[model samples]
Target: MAQVHLLANRKGGVGKSLISLNMGAVCADTAGARPDGRPSVAVASADPQGTSLWRAARLADQPFDVLDISGDVANVALLKSLPYDHIWVDTPGWAEITPEEYAAGKDPLGDEKYGTLLSALLDQADDVVVPILTEPDSFEPTWQTIEWVLKPRNVPFVVVINNWPPAEGIAYVEGTRAFCEGHGWPVARTVIRRYRVHTNATKVVTQYHNNRVELQAREDFFRFALEHGMRTAAAKEVVS
Candidate 1:
Protein backbone atom coordinates (compact mmCIF):
# COMPACT_ATOMS: atom_id res chain seq x y z
CA MET A 1 0.00 0.00 0.00
CA ALA A 2 1.17 3.56 -0.71
CA GLN A 3 1.86 5.89 2.18
CA VAL A 4 -0.07 9.12 2.58
CA HIS A 5 1.82 12.16 3.91
CA LEU A 6 0.18 15.49 4.58
CA LEU A 7 2.17 18.73 4.73
CA ALA A 8 -0.06 20.57 7.15
CA ASN A 9 0.15 23.53 9.50
CA ARG A 10 -2.37 26.21 10.29
CA LYS A 11 0.37 28.84 10.03
CA GLY A 12 0.75 30.60 6.70
CA GLY A 13 4.07 31.41 5.00
CA VAL A 14 5.63 28.33 6.50
CA GLY A 15 6.88 26.88 3.16
CA LYS A 16 4.37 24.00 3.09
CA SER A 17 3.92 23.60 -0.69
CA LEU A 18 7.62 23.89 -1.44
CA ILE A 19 8.38 21.13 1.00
CA SER A 20 5.56 19.04 -0.50
CA LEU A 21 6.98 19.31 -4.02
CA ASN A 22 10.57 18.59 -3.01
CA MET A 23 9.69 15.65 -0.81
CA GLY A 24 7.44 14.20 -3.51
CA ALA A 25 10.43 14.32 -5.84
CA VAL A 26 12.55 12.60 -3.25
CA CYS A 27 10.09 9.71 -3.29
CA ALA A 28 9.64 9.68 -7.08
CA ASP A 29 13.34 9.96 -7.79
CA THR A 30 14.60 7.34 -5.42
CA ALA A 31 17.63 6.00 -7.31
CA GLY A 32 17.32 2.44 -8.65
CA ALA A 33 13.93 1.97 -6.95
CA ARG A 34 11.55 2.47 -9.89
CA PRO A 35 11.83 -1.03 -11.25
CA ASP A 36 8.23 -1.74 -10.37
CA GLY A 37 7.44 0.92 -13.01
CA ARG A 38 4.50 2.30 -11.08
CA PRO A 39 3.33 5.83 -10.52
CA SER A 40 4.96 6.06 -7.14
CA VAL A 41 4.21 9.60 -6.03
CA ALA A 42 1.72 12.47 -6.21
CA VAL A 43 0.91 15.87 -4.60
CA ALA A 44 -2.57 17.15 -3.78
CA SER A 45 -3.26 20.83 -3.29
CA ALA A 46 -6.11 21.18 -0.85
CA ASP A 47 -5.59 24.95 -0.82
CA PRO A 48 -7.29 27.39 -3.14
CA GLN A 49 -3.92 29.05 -3.75
CA GLY A 50 -3.02 26.33 -6.31
CA THR A 51 0.65 26.48 -5.42
CA SER A 52 1.21 22.84 -6.32
CA LEU A 53 -0.55 23.20 -9.68
CA TRP A 54 1.59 26.21 -10.61
CA ARG A 55 4.73 24.39 -9.58
CA ALA A 56 3.73 21.33 -11.61
CA ALA A 57 3.05 23.41 -14.71
CA ARG A 58 6.44 25.03 -14.35
CA LEU A 59 8.39 21.80 -13.98
CA ALA A 60 6.29 19.96 -16.62
CA ASP A 61 8.75 17.12 -16.31
CA GLN A 62 8.17 16.09 -12.73
CA PRO A 63 7.67 12.36 -12.37
CA PHE A 64 4.37 12.51 -10.43
CA ASP A 65 0.94 14.04 -10.86
CA VAL A 66 -0.44 17.17 -9.14
CA LEU A 67 -4.02 16.98 -7.92
CA ASP A 68 -6.48 19.49 -6.53
CA ILE A 69 -8.79 18.74 -3.63
CA SER A 70 -11.66 21.01 -2.80
CA GLY A 71 -13.91 20.31 0.18
CA ASP A 72 -16.07 18.20 -2.11
CA VAL A 73 -16.65 14.71 -0.84
CA ALA A 74 -16.49 13.18 -4.32
CA ASN A 75 -13.01 14.51 -4.98
CA VAL A 76 -11.84 13.32 -1.60
CA ALA A 77 -13.23 9.88 -2.32
CA LEU A 78 -11.49 9.75 -5.69
CA LEU A 79 -8.19 10.59 -4.05
CA LYS A 80 -8.70 7.75 -1.62
CA SER A 81 -9.27 5.38 -4.53
CA LEU A 82 -6.00 6.12 -6.30
CA PRO A 83 -3.19 3.58 -6.19
CA TYR A 84 -0.08 5.54 -5.40
CA ASP A 85 3.09 5.00 -3.45
CA HIS A 86 3.10 8.38 -1.74
CA ILE A 87 0.16 10.76 -1.70
CA TRP A 88 1.17 14.16 -0.34
CA VAL A 89 -1.39 16.79 0.55
CA ASP A 90 -0.63 20.50 1.03
CA THR A 91 -3.44 21.89 3.17
CA PRO A 92 -4.41 25.54 3.53
CA GLY A 93 -2.68 27.27 6.40
CA TRP A 94 -4.84 27.89 9.46
CA ALA A 95 -7.91 26.47 7.84
CA GLU A 96 -9.48 27.36 11.14
CA ILE A 97 -8.11 30.86 11.74
CA THR A 98 -10.77 32.97 10.06
CA PRO A 99 -13.06 32.94 13.10
CA GLU A 100 -10.16 33.74 15.36
CA GLU A 101 -9.26 36.77 13.26
CA TYR A 102 -12.87 37.93 13.35
CA ALA A 103 -13.26 37.41 17.07
CA ALA A 104 -10.03 39.29 17.80
CA GLY A 105 -9.04 36.22 19.70
CA LYS A 106 -5.45 35.13 20.22
CA ASP A 107 -6.35 31.56 19.27
CA PRO A 108 -5.61 31.18 15.60
CA LEU A 109 -7.85 28.20 14.95
CA GLY A 110 -11.05 29.89 15.94
CA ASP A 111 -12.79 29.11 12.66
CA GLU A 112 -14.96 25.99 12.45
CA LYS A 113 -13.94 24.92 8.92
CA TYR A 114 -10.41 24.40 10.15
CA GLY A 115 -11.67 21.81 12.55
CA THR A 116 -13.78 20.09 9.91
CA LEU A 117 -11.04 20.03 7.28
CA LEU A 118 -8.41 18.98 9.75
CA SER A 119 -10.57 16.10 10.95
CA ALA A 120 -11.18 14.89 7.41
CA LEU A 121 -7.54 15.30 6.36
CA LEU A 122 -6.15 13.49 9.38
CA ASP A 123 -8.55 10.62 8.87
CA GLN A 124 -6.83 9.90 5.53
CA ALA A 125 -3.25 10.63 6.48
CA ASP A 126 -0.80 8.13 7.94
CA ASP A 127 1.48 10.94 9.05
CA VAL A 128 1.30 14.71 9.26
CA VAL A 129 4.32 17.01 9.10
CA VAL A 130 4.01 20.47 10.60
CA PRO A 131 6.47 23.14 9.51
CA ILE A 132 6.95 25.91 12.03
CA LEU A 133 8.78 29.23 12.02
CA THR A 134 11.00 29.96 15.01
CA GLU A 135 9.72 33.43 15.86
CA PRO A 136 7.25 34.11 18.67
CA ASP A 137 4.41 34.96 16.28
CA SER A 138 4.53 31.55 14.56
CA PHE A 139 4.87 29.47 17.70
CA GLU A 140 1.36 29.67 19.15
CA PRO A 141 -0.47 28.53 16.05
CA THR A 142 1.92 25.62 15.78
CA TRP A 143 1.02 24.39 19.22
CA GLN A 144 -2.65 25.18 18.77
CA THR A 145 -2.86 23.14 15.60
CA ILE A 146 -0.90 20.29 17.18
CA GLU A 147 -3.22 20.18 20.11
CA TRP A 148 -6.25 20.17 17.86
CA VAL A 149 -4.94 17.33 15.73
CA LEU A 150 -3.91 15.10 18.62
CA LYS A 151 -7.20 15.07 20.49
CA PRO A 152 -9.24 11.84 20.06
CA ARG A 153 -7.36 11.28 16.77
CA ASN A 154 -3.86 10.22 17.75
CA VAL A 155 -2.46 11.51 14.45
CA PRO A 156 1.32 11.08 14.41
CA PHE A 157 3.26 14.20 13.42
CA VAL A 158 6.63 15.94 13.56
CA VAL A 159 7.48 19.64 13.79
CA VAL A 160 10.04 20.99 11.37
CA ILE A 161 11.74 24.38 11.79
CA ASN A 162 11.60 26.34 8.53
CA ASN A 163 13.06 29.67 7.39
CA TRP A 164 15.76 29.21 9.94
CA PRO A 165 18.30 31.88 9.18
CA PRO A 166 21.60 31.43 10.91
CA ALA A 167 21.78 35.13 11.61
CA GLU A 168 18.52 34.96 13.57
CA GLY A 169 20.92 33.44 16.13
CA ILE A 170 20.81 30.27 18.12
CA ALA A 171 18.81 31.86 20.91
CA TYR A 172 15.55 31.83 18.91
CA VAL A 173 16.20 28.33 17.66
CA GLU A 174 16.87 27.03 21.15
CA GLY A 175 13.74 28.70 22.43
CA THR A 176 11.67 26.97 19.77
CA ARG A 177 13.20 23.65 20.81
CA ALA A 178 12.45 24.27 24.47
CA PHE A 179 8.84 25.04 23.67
CA CYS A 180 8.34 21.84 21.68
CA GLU A 181 10.11 19.75 24.30
CA GLY A 182 7.94 21.23 27.01
CA HIS A 183 4.87 20.14 25.05
CA GLY A 184 6.19 16.71 23.94
CA TRP A 185 6.13 17.39 20.22
CA PRO A 186 8.66 15.63 18.04
CA VAL A 187 11.09 18.20 16.56
CA ALA A 188 13.05 17.08 13.54
CA ARG A 189 16.77 17.04 14.25
CA THR A 190 17.55 18.53 10.84
CA VAL A 191 16.77 22.25 10.80
CA ILE A 192 16.20 23.63 7.29
CA ARG A 193 18.35 26.77 7.14
CA ARG A 194 17.00 29.79 5.38
CA TYR A 195 18.72 30.23 2.02
CA ARG A 196 18.54 32.78 -0.76
CA VAL A 197 18.40 29.96 -3.29
CA HIS A 198 15.12 28.67 -1.85
CA THR A 199 13.47 32.05 -2.36
CA ASN A 200 14.90 32.55 -5.86
CA ALA A 201 13.96 29.11 -7.10
CA THR A 202 10.36 29.35 -5.84
CA LYS A 203 9.81 32.43 -8.01
CA VAL A 204 10.06 30.40 -11.27
CA VAL A 205 7.99 27.24 -10.53
CA THR A 206 11.16 25.25 -10.11
CA GLN A 207 10.30 21.81 -8.73
CA TYR A 208 12.94 19.65 -7.10
CA HIS A 209 15.67 22.01 -8.29
CA ASN A 210 17.99 22.95 -5.45
CA ASN A 211 21.30 24.71 -5.13
CA ARG A 212 23.97 23.50 -2.70
CA VAL A 213 22.41 25.20 0.30
CA GLU A 214 18.86 24.03 -0.41
CA LEU A 215 20.18 20.59 -1.25
CA GLN A 216 21.79 20.45 2.17
CA ALA A 217 18.47 21.48 3.65
CA ARG A 218 16.76 18.68 1.74
CA GLU A 219 19.21 16.15 3.13
CA ASP A 220 18.52 17.40 6.62
CA PHE A 221 14.79 16.92 6.09
CA PHE A 222 15.37 13.43 4.73
CA ARG A 223 17.43 12.52 7.77
CA PHE A 224 14.61 13.65 10.01
CA ALA A 225 12.12 11.52 8.11
CA LEU A 226 14.46 8.55 8.36
CA GLU A 227 14.95 8.90 12.10
CA HIS A 228 11.23 9.18 12.69
CA GLY A 229 10.44 5.80 11.03
CA MET A 230 8.93 7.54 8.04
CA ARG A 231 9.84 6.33 4.56
CA THR A 232 13.21 7.38 3.09
CA ALA A 233 16.07 5.96 1.01
CA ALA A 234 16.58 3.25 3.59
CA ALA A 235 13.12 1.90 2.89
CA LYS A 236 13.82 2.00 -0.84
CA GLU A 237 17.01 0.05 -0.26
CA VAL A 238 14.94 -2.94 0.71
CA VAL A 239 13.04 -2.88 -2.57
CA SER A 240 16.19 -2.25 -4.59
Candidate 2:
Protein backbone atom coordinates (compact mmCIF):
# COMPACT_ATOMS: atom_id res chain seq x y z
CA MET A 1 0.00 0.00 0.00
CA ALA A 2 1.19 3.53 -0.78
CA GLN A 3 1.80 6.03 1.97
CA VAL A 4 -0.04 9.28 1.32
CA HIS A 5 1.75 12.50 2.22
CA LEU A 6 -0.06 15.81 2.15
CA LEU A 7 1.53 19.22 1.64
CA ALA A 8 -0.87 21.51 3.45
CA ASN A 9 -1.13 24.92 5.06
CA ARG A 10 -4.07 27.27 5.37
CA LYS A 11 -1.95 30.26 4.43
CA GLY A 12 -0.80 30.87 0.87
CA GLY A 13 2.63 31.92 -0.45
CA VAL A 14 4.38 29.50 1.86
CA GLY A 15 6.01 27.40 -0.88
CA LYS A 16 3.57 24.49 -0.47
CA SER A 17 3.32 23.72 -4.20
CA LEU A 18 7.04 24.06 -4.77
CA ILE A 19 7.81 21.68 -1.93
CA SER A 20 5.15 19.25 -3.13
CA LEU A 21 6.45 19.11 -6.69
CA ASN A 22 10.08 18.71 -5.74
CA MET A 23 9.43 16.22 -2.95
CA GLY A 24 7.14 14.16 -5.18
CA ALA A 25 9.77 14.08 -7.91
CA VAL A 26 12.46 13.05 -5.48
CA CYS A 27 10.29 10.32 -4.00
CA ALA A 28 9.61 8.99 -7.49
CA ASP A 29 13.28 9.10 -8.40
CA THR A 30 14.37 7.31 -5.26
CA ALA A 31 11.59 4.78 -4.81
CA GLY A 32 12.29 1.15 -5.61
CA ALA A 33 10.24 -0.18 -8.48
CA ARG A 34 7.30 -2.49 -7.87
CA PRO A 35 7.49 -6.22 -8.61
CA ASP A 36 5.86 -5.49 -11.97
CA GLY A 37 8.71 -3.05 -12.84
CA ARG A 38 6.48 0.01 -12.71
CA PRO A 39 7.58 3.18 -10.92
CA SER A 40 6.42 3.29 -7.32
CA VAL A 41 5.64 6.94 -6.85
CA ALA A 42 2.90 9.35 -7.96
CA VAL A 43 1.49 12.78 -7.08
CA ALA A 44 -2.12 13.84 -6.58
CA SER A 45 -3.24 17.45 -6.86
CA ALA A 46 -6.16 18.35 -4.63
CA ASP A 47 -5.73 22.05 -5.17
CA PRO A 48 -8.39 23.62 -7.37
CA GLN A 49 -5.81 25.90 -9.02
CA GLY A 50 -4.08 22.89 -10.65
CA THR A 51 -0.68 24.51 -10.45
CA SER A 52 1.07 21.20 -9.87
CA LEU A 53 -0.85 19.62 -12.74
CA TRP A 54 0.16 22.44 -15.06
CA ARG A 55 3.82 22.04 -14.15
CA ALA A 56 3.68 18.30 -14.61
CA ALA A 57 2.11 18.76 -18.02
CA ARG A 58 4.92 21.11 -19.04
CA LEU A 59 7.46 18.42 -18.42
CA ALA A 60 8.35 16.39 -21.49
CA ASP A 61 8.89 13.30 -19.38
CA GLN A 62 7.64 13.38 -15.85
CA PRO A 63 9.70 11.74 -13.13
CA PHE A 64 6.54 10.03 -11.96
CA ASP A 65 2.82 9.88 -12.70
CA VAL A 66 0.76 12.98 -11.91
CA LEU A 67 -2.96 12.70 -11.15
CA ASP A 68 -5.27 15.68 -10.97
CA ILE A 69 -7.51 14.42 -8.20
CA SER A 70 -9.27 17.73 -7.89
CA GLY A 71 -12.91 18.70 -7.10
CA ASP A 72 -14.54 15.41 -6.12
CA VAL A 73 -14.52 13.27 -3.00
CA ALA A 74 -14.48 10.24 -5.30
CA ASN A 75 -11.07 11.27 -6.57
CA VAL A 76 -9.64 10.78 -3.10
CA ALA A 77 -10.90 7.22 -3.12
CA LEU A 78 -9.46 6.74 -6.57
CA LEU A 79 -6.00 7.69 -5.33
CA LYS A 80 -6.12 4.87 -2.75
CA SER A 81 -6.48 2.28 -5.48
CA LEU A 82 -3.44 3.41 -7.49
CA PRO A 83 -0.40 1.16 -7.33
CA TYR A 84 2.38 3.37 -6.02
CA ASP A 85 4.79 3.19 -3.11
CA HIS A 86 4.38 6.83 -2.24
CA ILE A 87 1.68 9.34 -3.16
CA TRP A 88 2.14 13.03 -2.47
CA VAL A 89 -0.98 15.20 -2.28
CA ASP A 90 -0.77 18.90 -3.11
CA THR A 91 -3.64 20.48 -1.18
CA PRO A 92 -5.04 24.00 -1.42
CA GLY A 93 -3.86 26.78 0.92
CA TRP A 94 -7.26 27.39 2.46
CA ALA A 95 -7.87 24.73 5.10
CA GLU A 96 -9.87 26.58 7.74
CA ILE A 97 -13.65 26.65 7.42
CA THR A 98 -15.25 29.31 9.54
CA PRO A 99 -18.39 28.41 11.49
CA GLU A 100 -20.30 31.14 9.65
CA GLU A 101 -19.37 29.69 6.27
CA TYR A 102 -20.30 26.20 7.38
CA ALA A 103 -23.65 27.40 8.74
CA ALA A 104 -24.27 29.21 5.44
CA GLY A 105 -23.70 25.96 3.53
CA LYS A 106 -20.48 27.29 1.99
CA ASP A 107 -17.68 24.82 1.43
CA PRO A 108 -14.14 25.59 2.46
CA LEU A 109 -12.63 23.72 -0.48
CA GLY A 110 -13.51 26.86 -2.45
CA ASP A 111 -15.27 27.17 -5.80
CA GLU A 112 -14.34 23.62 -6.65
CA LYS A 113 -17.75 22.64 -5.17
CA TYR A 114 -16.45 19.53 -3.53
CA GLY A 115 -18.01 19.34 -0.10
CA THR A 116 -15.78 17.81 2.59
CA LEU A 117 -13.23 16.82 -0.03
CA LEU A 118 -10.39 18.37 1.93
CA SER A 119 -11.45 16.51 5.06
CA ALA A 120 -11.56 13.29 3.09
CA LEU A 121 -8.06 13.89 1.78
CA LEU A 122 -6.78 14.57 5.29
CA ASP A 123 -8.35 11.38 6.52
CA GLN A 124 -6.40 9.41 3.93
CA ALA A 125 -3.07 11.04 4.57
CA ASP A 126 -0.45 9.07 6.50
CA ASP A 127 1.65 12.11 7.03
CA VAL A 128 1.50 15.85 6.41
CA VAL A 129 4.14 18.43 5.48
CA VAL A 130 3.39 21.99 6.48
CA PRO A 131 5.37 24.79 4.83
CA ILE A 132 5.43 27.95 6.91
CA LEU A 133 6.93 31.40 6.49
CA THR A 134 8.65 33.12 9.42
CA GLU A 135 6.13 35.89 9.77
CA PRO A 136 3.28 36.67 12.14
CA ASP A 137 0.48 36.47 9.56
CA SER A 138 1.72 33.18 8.14
CA PHE A 139 2.41 31.70 11.57
CA GLU A 140 -1.15 32.28 12.77
CA PRO A 141 -2.83 30.11 10.16
CA THR A 142 -0.13 27.49 10.25
CA TRP A 143 -0.54 27.12 13.99
CA GLN A 144 -4.30 26.93 13.70
CA THR A 145 -4.12 24.18 11.11
CA ILE A 146 -1.79 22.20 13.31
CA GLU A 147 -3.75 22.70 16.50
CA TRP A 148 -7.25 22.36 15.10
CA VAL A 149 -6.77 19.68 12.47
CA LEU A 150 -3.57 17.63 12.66
CA LYS A 151 -3.47 17.45 16.43
CA PRO A 152 -7.10 16.45 16.66
CA ARG A 153 -6.58 13.70 14.14
CA ASN A 154 -3.36 12.52 15.83
CA VAL A 155 -1.52 12.76 12.51
CA PRO A 156 2.25 13.01 12.34
CA PHE A 157 3.56 16.23 10.77
CA VAL A 158 6.60 18.44 10.42
CA VAL A 159 6.69 22.19 10.01
CA VAL A 160 9.27 23.38 7.48
CA ILE A 161 10.42 26.97 7.46
CA ASN A 162 10.47 27.87 3.78
CA ASN A 163 11.81 30.88 1.87
CA TRP A 164 13.70 32.07 4.93
CA PRO A 165 15.63 35.26 4.55
CA PRO A 166 19.42 35.21 4.65
CA ALA A 167 21.59 36.63 7.44
CA GLU A 168 19.21 39.41 8.39
CA GLY A 169 16.37 36.94 8.96
CA ILE A 170 18.33 34.68 11.28
CA ALA A 171 16.71 36.04 14.40
CA TYR A 172 13.23 35.61 13.03
CA VAL A 173 13.95 32.01 12.02
CA GLU A 174 15.34 31.23 15.45
CA GLY A 175 12.31 32.74 17.09
CA THR A 176 9.95 30.73 14.97
CA ARG A 177 11.82 27.50 15.64
CA ALA A 178 11.73 28.19 19.36
CA PHE A 179 8.03 28.87 19.24
CA CYS A 180 7.25 25.61 17.46
CA GLU A 181 9.48 23.63 19.78
CA GLY A 182 7.78 25.18 22.78
CA HIS A 183 4.42 24.14 21.41
CA GLY A 184 5.63 20.55 20.99
CA TRP A 185 5.47 20.65 17.22
CA PRO A 186 8.12 18.93 15.17
CA VAL A 187 10.00 21.49 13.11
CA ALA A 188 12.54 20.45 10.52
CA ARG A 189 16.11 21.37 11.27
CA THR A 190 16.67 22.27 7.63
CA VAL A 191 15.69 25.80 6.64
CA ILE A 192 15.12 26.66 2.98
CA ARG A 193 16.49 30.06 2.06
CA ARG A 194 14.99 32.35 -0.55
CA TYR A 195 16.53 31.66 -3.93
CA ARG A 196 15.93 32.72 -7.49
CA VAL A 197 16.05 29.12 -8.63
CA HIS A 198 13.17 28.06 -6.40
CA THR A 199 11.14 31.09 -7.52
CA ASN A 200 11.61 30.16 -11.20
CA ALA A 201 11.47 26.37 -10.77
CA THR A 202 7.84 26.13 -11.92
CA LYS A 203 8.77 27.50 -15.36
CA VAL A 204 10.61 24.29 -16.17
CA VAL A 205 10.68 20.64 -15.22
CA THR A 206 13.10 20.78 -12.33
CA GLN A 207 13.86 18.70 -9.23
CA TYR A 208 16.58 18.72 -6.64
CA HIS A 209 18.62 16.23 -8.71
CA ASN A 210 18.67 18.53 -11.78
CA ASN A 211 18.77 21.92 -10.10
CA ARG A 212 22.09 23.77 -10.51
CA VAL A 213 21.82 27.30 -9.20
CA GLU A 214 20.45 26.67 -5.71
CA LEU A 215 22.08 23.49 -4.57
CA GLN A 216 21.63 24.47 -0.95
CA ALA A 217 17.86 24.42 -1.31
CA ARG A 218 18.05 20.86 -2.54
CA GLU A 219 20.37 19.97 0.30
CA ASP A 220 17.97 21.47 2.76
CA PHE A 221 15.13 19.36 1.41
CA PHE A 222 17.22 16.24 1.63
CA ARG A 223 18.02 16.94 5.23
CA PHE A 224 14.37 17.54 5.99
CA ALA A 225 13.44 14.25 4.33
CA LEU A 226 16.05 12.44 6.32
CA GLU A 227 14.77 13.89 9.54
CA HIS A 228 11.22 12.85 8.68
CA GLY A 229 12.27 9.20 8.11
CA MET A 230 11.57 9.42 4.37
CA ARG A 231 15.19 8.54 3.61
CA THR A 232 15.21 5.21 5.44
CA ALA A 233 13.57 3.30 2.59
CA ALA A 234 16.32 3.67 -0.07
CA ALA A 235 18.60 6.46 1.02
CA LYS A 236 21.90 4.88 0.05
CA GLU A 237 20.73 3.85 -3.37
CA VAL A 238 19.17 7.24 -4.01
CA VAL A 239 22.26 9.14 -2.98
CA SER A 240 24.62 6.85 -4.84
| Number of the predicted model whose TM-score against the real structure is largest | 2
Which window of 10 residues has the lowest lDDT sum in candidate 2? Answer: 201-210
Q: In candidate 1, what are the lDDT values of residues 1-240, reduced to their tens digit?
A: 557788877778898887787667666665223457655678888877777777767774666777777455345645556778788888887545444463674444333554455557778877788888888888877876787555446776788887789887988889998899899888877777776655554432224346665566666546654564544444456558
Question: How far in Å is the alpha carbon of 76 misplaced in model 1?
Answer: 1.9
Q: What is the C-alpha lDDT profile of model 2 across 1-240, one tens digit per residue?
A: 778889888887787777787777667666766787777888788888887887777766677778877866766865666899888888877656776875696644565443366688888887899898888788878887787668878777889988887866589899889888988998888887877766664432235445465566676666666676653344435546
Query: Per-prediction TM-score, please?
Result: 0.78, 0.82
Runs in model 2 lying further than 4 Å from the true structure: 32-37, 95-115, 202-212, 230-240
Residue pairs with clashing backbones, model 1: 10-94
What is the overall TM-score of model 2 with all chains considered together? Answer: 0.82
> What is the lDDT of every predicted structure here?
0.69, 0.75
What are the C-alpha RMSDs, in order, of all predicted structures?
A: 5.4, 5.3
